[model samples]
Structures are given as structure tokens and as C-alpha cells.
Target: MSILITGATGTIGSLITARLAEAGAEVKALVRQAGKRDFPAGVTEVIADLTDVPSMRAALSSVRTLFLLNAVTPDEVTQALITLNLAREAGIERIVYLSVIHADKFTNVPHFTGKHTVERMIESHGVPATILRPAYFMQNELMVQQTLRDYGVYPMPIGSKGVSMIDARDIADVAVAELLRRDRAPTALDRVTLELVGPQALTGAAVAQAWSLALSREVAYGGDDVAAFEGQMASFGPSWLAYDMRLMMAGIQAFGMQAEDGTVERLQAILGRPLRTYDDFVREAAGQA
Candidate 1:
């Protein structure tokens, strides 16, 4: 059975698919569209949407390991519960699901709450599961790339709260490592939850300084009005996705998004190499630019 990668078009999911494909692992991508996006060589792409349980089940037919990524949909609750049920029915032996750090505690955020729901569903199923609870993605850096380039700065609601902002690519690296050679990983699949994080934790001001140094521009942060941000997002943003980010950001501004333990040792212990740092991430983004 091949590895079934859901949300293969997304950032971390794409990285996981590529890393697995490059390593010559048998992977089948669950996609809703074919020839719509580029993927790695020797990767099989299957057209399946998470909303359709039968299609998802069909895609999971011969899959042993399932890498589940949260998909933003208007009907997120329905889709998430159905997907978990189908995975169980398909007899998938292993599940590596990506969830946020404060998934279990957050309720204002519908998406995170749904993720927590999915985690519970996975637990109810007898399948061996590895839940990777990563903090906020560093890839959000790209959203303000233009702002950074023009104003030479990055900004967020991060106050004194030091968060272990993880590189999504590193999260993907961990996912591929955790799933590809199952027996070689931490071996705590069923009874454990892994928190993936970057090399260091820094405040928003500290992050701005890092960006300033990296891009040679004085990046500044601007935000204290949670209402303002939420309003802006709700009005002009993608319908289903707008609130998820706002609710998560509200938690961040209020100090709910920070990682409990330092993430360096655990990250290093898993990857056998230093996890990617914010500086490295900035450099990679700069290179892409």
C-alpha cells in the first residue's frame, strides 16, 4: 500500500510529498484536481476532495500510512469527522496528522476546534497515530512579503510571549521522517504527541530585528487592535479561512500560541540535524524572491 498524502497542494503537505517522492517512497497524493499544480517526479496524484467520504475512502483503499493536513472549508466539521471515519474504515495502520499547538484548548477558533475534534476521532479509532502539534507557521512571513519589502519590516501581535515559530518545511521534514521509516522515528506513535518547533523563540520585536538584519531594512510591527485585525480579515478575506486566522491571532496577541517547552532539543532529537531557524527561513524566502 502506498502512502496517501491529503492536502498535497499545501505548503507542508507539498514539502512532505516532495521529500517522500525524492526519497523514492511509494506515495499517492489525494488531490481534487489533476494537472492543476506541479508535484515531484514519480508521485501518484489521486483526485479526491475531503468533503466526499466515498472518494476519500477510495483513495485510501491501499494506503497504510496517512498524512492528514487540515483543509479549510465552509463545512470543516463535516469534512474532518468524515475523513477520520473513512481512514478507520480503510484500515489505515498509521496516521500522522498536523495540528496547531493549542488545539485542545482553543474554542474561539472553529478550525482548531475541528482539528481537536479530528484528533479525538483518530484516538477513538484503533489506528496507530502520531499527532504533530506545531506552533504558528513561519511561512506566514510570505503574506507580508510586500509589506516587508516596501517598509523593510515585519509586524504581528506577538508581545512578551515568546513562541517557538516553526518552519512549516521543518514540520514537513519531521512528518516525512516520522512516517517514511516508521520504526526508526521516536517509536511513540500511539501514546504520544510531538510538538514541532524551530531553533529559537523570539518576540515580535525580536523577529522584526531579525528581518531587518536579513533584508537590510528596518522592519516594523504594527498591531494591538485585535478588533481591527479581525474586522479587516472578516470583510476582505477568504470566507472560510478568515475567522480561523483571526481567532488564532487573537490567541497569539493574548499569549495563547506560545510553546510550553523549548523546541530545539526535541526537534534535534528527531531530525538528527539542526532544525531550520528563522534566519535560515528568511534567507530561503529571500532566495526565492
Candidate 2:
């Protein structure tokens, strides 16, 4: 039985797909359209959209494991619920869901609330799944690279509370391990939840300091200004999405996206190495800058 991956074109999904395929596992990637992207050799491309029932059914057919990752969209709830219900109908043995950290607690954030709703359904229905709750992606800094280079500022409004920003690559590695374990088991594994996070929590100023060290110059922390951040986001995308992100950022600023104690130790044991640090990410980003 093959492992089917949704959101397969995205950064973390792509990494997981490539690694699974390289490990000689049977893999299938769900794509909205064909020929728009490429996958590693021996990986099957399953043309499907999350909202298209017939297509989703075909994609889930004969699949043993699923990596359920729906992009944050207006209809994220509908898409995820539909795909998940279909997975159950198909009797899929294992599912790995990518959810945000503190999804249940972040009730005001649209995407977080939507994921929490899905999490509730999964728990209520007893789906054999592994829920990976990851914190803010360190790679998100790539979007502000130009700003950092020219203005010497770290522009994200992650505040003084501190966030344990995780690496997408590390998330992918943990996902691959979970998928393999569930898929190779003789019977379906029990449901589980894993909080994915970086090794240490860093505040906005700390992140700026890391960039400063990496670039050998002073970099200022762009203070917590969710309104300004929202306005900036709205200039590039839908206002509603920007507002939704504003709520998420406001929540982050108020309550920091921190991992529980010993989370780092547990993650290290799982990956057989230390978690990736923001300092390393900064150094690499600066080197390329």
C-alpha cells in the first residue's frame, strides 16, 4: 500500500515526499493539476483536489497512509472535513495530520480554529492518526529576506513572549518517521499527538540578535504591531486572510508559541539528533544574502 500526501507541492510536504520516495517506499502525491510540478522518480502523482469528491476518492483508493496537509484557505474546513471523511470511508489505516501548536487554545484565529475543529472530529471519531502540532516555521523568515538585507530589521511581529520556531525540514523528517512506523506496522497504530518544535524559544529581539550575528551588523527587532503587519499583508493578498493572520499574530504576541518542557528532548530522541536551531537558519540565510 502506498502513502498518499496532500499539499504535496508545499515545502514540508515536498521534503517528506522526496525522502519517502528515496527510502524506496511506495508514495503518491495529490496535485490539483498535472505537469505543474515534478516529483522524485518512482513516486506516483495522483491528480486530485481536496474539494473534488470523485478525485479525492480515487486518490485515497488503495492507500494505506495519508499525510493530510491542507493549505490555509477560505474553505480549509470544508476541504479537510471532506478529505478526512473520505479517508475514513476508504478505511485508510493511518493518517498524519499537520496542525498548528495550541490550535485548541487559539480560538480566535481562523486557521487555528479550523484545525481544532478537525482535531475534535478526529478524536471524537477515533481515527488512528498522529497529529503533528508545529510552531511558527523558521522558513517564514525567507519572505522578509529583502527587508532584512536592506533595512537591517527582522520584520515579523512575533513578540517578547518567545516562539520556538521550527524548521520545515525537521518537521518533514519527523513526519517521514511517523509515516513509516504506521505503514509498516502489522495493524493500525494507536492515535497519537506529537508537538513539533525547535530546540529553543527565542523572542523577537533574540531573533534579531541572531540575524545581527549572522550578518555581522546590527538588526533591529520590528516591534509587535499587528495592525501594521496586517496592512502590509493586505497589500499583497486578500484582506480577510491578512486579518486572519493578524489574529494569529496577536495570539502569538499575547501567548507565545512555546513548546512544552522536555519537548526538545523527546524530539531529539525521535530524530536521533538535535533539533535545528534558528541561529543556523539565520547563518545560512545570511550567507545566501
Top-TM-score candidate index: 2
Pairs that collide, model 1:
152-219, 153-219
Q: State the lDDT of candidate 1 residue by residue for 123-180, as single tens digits.
A: 7765577888998789987887877888765556666567778888788988998787
Per-prediction TM-score? 0.91, 0.99
Question: What value does the lDDT take at residue 38 in candidate 2?
Answer: 89
What's the lDDT for residue 22 in model 1? 90
Steric clashes per prediction: 2, 0
Instruction: Please identify model 1 stretches exceeding 4 Å from their true place.
Output: 183-189
Cα deviation of 213, candidate 1, in Å: 1.4
For 1-289, candidate 2 gives per-residue lDDT tens digits of: 8999998899989999999999899999888888767899998999999999999998898899999998999999999999999999999969999999999888999999999999999999999999999999999999998888799998899899989999999999999999999999989889999999998889999999998889888999999999999999999999999999999999999999988899999999999999999999989888987
Model 2 spans > 4 angstroms off: none
Quote the lDDT for 22 in model 2: 90
Global CA lDDT computed for model 2:
0.93
Which candidate has the top score in lDDT? Answer: 2
